[model samples]
Target: MLRPVVVGLDGSRESLTAADWAAREALRRGLPLRLVHAADAPAAGGSDLPELSAPRHWARRILRDAMDQINERYPRLYLSAEQIARPAAEALVSAGGAGELLVLGSRAFSGFGGFLAGSVALQTVTRVERPVVLVRADQTVEDEHTPDPEGRPSADTPYRAVVVGVDAVRPAEQVLAFAFESAALRSTPLRAVYAWRLPMVRAVAEAGAHQTEEAAARRALTAALAPWREKFPTVEVVEQAEEGHPAQRLLSAAQDAGLLAVGRPIRPARLGAHTGPVAHAVMHHVRCPVAIVPHE
Candidate 1:
């Protein structure tokens, strides 16, 4: 059986945006879409509030409304809805195991306040084995495509390049494969960005030594991506090595990207936060959709 694209919905505008993004992705991948809503368990003695007393009913309504809107937009798409009686993060992480891709919504923060991914979004991304895409509340299809020459909207605009952050010293195969495959699927270029910085002790060593270090970094990145480039011959690959912070460079590279892919080291829930600082930063700040891929 083909795995379906799953999305967590909570009747919030952010979640609705995620559903929209997931629907398009499902259609692109020729997979079914599953919408999941987690209804929190009622209070110890059962509260007097109607919503708390009938949590399932409220969840069903949220799902129904979402299903209706998605159905109207994609009548031919196969869609299903379910309600789980558990905490939102737990429900999403469990559902993610059986999904090809799990999508969640995050509200965009204004100015430099940073994003609010919520506890559920952060926890789910850290724990899920599959790739989890976080879509901003205001993200739209047009944002994923390149603008026309006249700077006007057009349906025929091609998608922007797919950007992937790589740690040359410890490249993740899963992350590289996902980036290459996504670029191939969209028939777009892949930008592999690897950022490095000279240690403080080595900053004033020598000019020639600095050049050698830079060369070595570039070679490492090339070697790391060689196999993936062969695997995806049709994908145009652009390798970039910059001397700076990884997160800062990635943020710069993602300015014009359609999707940014980053790797999260797989860590057991008991070990606390698993997402690295770079992945966490990009997920919250990148304007385009962000894909958090888990790898061992």
Candidate 2:
């Protein structure tokens, strides 16, 4: 059986927006949609306490409201709702592990020029083994497609490309696979990007040396993509080998992209959880949905 597309809700507008995005994706994948809400369990022997009643009611309301909105939007989708009596991060981690992927909402910082990824969402994303997609509240279906000839947002236009960052020296198969599959599903192009910085040596900064390094990077990128290109012959692949920071180049390439996917190495528990600098920067600033895929 195919795993369901799960979304975490918290009665916030952002979470509701995420549910809408997840429903659309679930429909595309021909999978079920699961709506989940996490709340702290009531105090010991205080299940019926007057103070605890409101929160319990609120949790149920959150789930019901989200269900109603999604059902109205996608009448034919297979959907389910669950309210977990646990902390937000723990509940999301467990629930996401049981699904194909997890969708969560991230609030954009108003004047602060970045995403307001909360603690619970960040924690779950960094710890979960499955892919986690973070959607902003302002996202809409039209944003996934190219603008109409009139320069107006329209969903009927072709989908924008899906962008993925690749490291020529240490490429992860999981990240490449996810990116290619996403482009195939959307019937859009897949852009493979690799960026690097010149060594501190002055000799390497010469025009001749720069050309040599760029040639090497491009050759490695082509070599790394050979197998996948063969496997996904229909996907139009565009390779960009640039000299710069990975995050900045990715952001520029993804300006008009439908989705941006990046990988995170699964670290041992003793090492603690954290998003790498590349993932961190994109998550905060990218306009499109960011898919964080965990790989070994």
Candidate 3:
């Protein structure tokens, strides 16, 4: 099983923005966003305080309050929060797991105000095993518009250039639907890269032969997506059959991509409840933020 989605919220403006982004995404993907608030609880009561009196237990309560306030605004969002005695980034990193997408809002950590980029966000994004999205507090999302060769708006983001990894197993159809819609939203181009390697076939020697395989792969991919393409005629499509590891091909193709979408296939024996080879590698190596559509 892929792990769950989690977002870190520390009651800061950036954290709140992160919460908003996470909530909206969870709603879109029909998944729950685990909102977390790690607080600093005093290890021991101050010596000055009278021993007979009870110390205030506020850390856990504070977390609950923040979570409640968030849920009130996004009532439909399924969220849960708890307090723990650890650094906020560490708390978030600990929550990372299979299928989980970690999101953080950007801002400086010093004296109450600065730019959106923060050390915590950077650390989480760079180190996590699953996908991490570092969103600016002021990040305003807009629909993608493909520009023509002359740099003009094309067909409302053409649903073109949608890419998906196909291994004929585990990844659900819902992932495909998301890829199609995302491409349609951008009206850009559509391409799929399925990397494969045979034990005896040396790939470096057959770059030309791989071109033919790429063509055939395109046909197979088209056949699979035939219904969707017929339904949305404006969407252009392409496919790549590369002779290498699946993960490397995906990372290479996604380097200049607007959006990279992948499926978290069912847990494999070796992968241990994680996204398959391609998605896992992309999550770490790609410079672009990826949309990990869990094969739910």
**Clashes per candidate (backbone, < 3 Å):** 0, 0, 13
Encode model 2's per-residue lDDT on 192-254: one tens digit a residue.
999977676844557577777888999999998989999999999999999999999999998
Candidate 3 residue-wise lDDT, 1-296, digit = tens: 43455777766676676677677666656677786766545458645555423323444554566677768877887776656557766776677543357776665324532234456654554345565654445433321224557766564443224466655323357566666665665565676666666444734666666566656665665566676677657767666766678777787786556556776644444744444566656654554435655554
Stronger candidate by lDDT (2 vs 3): 2
Tens-place lDDT digits, model 1, residues 1-296: 98999999999999999999999888888999999999776657766777555766778899999999999999989999999878998999999889998999988888742356998898889889999999988888788789899997554799889999999999999999889988988889999999988886776766676787889999999999999988999999999999999999999999989899999998776887668999989977888889999998
The C-alpha TM-scores of every prediction are: 0.93, 0.96, 0.51
Which prediction has the highest TM-score against the true structure? Answer: 2
Best by lDDT: 2
Off by over 4 Å in 1: 42-54, 268-270
**What lDDT does model 1 reach?**
0.89
Report the Cα lDDT for candidate 3.
Answer: 0.59
For model 2 the local lDDT of residue 205 reads: 55
Overall lDDT per candidate, in order of appearance: 0.89, 0.91, 0.59
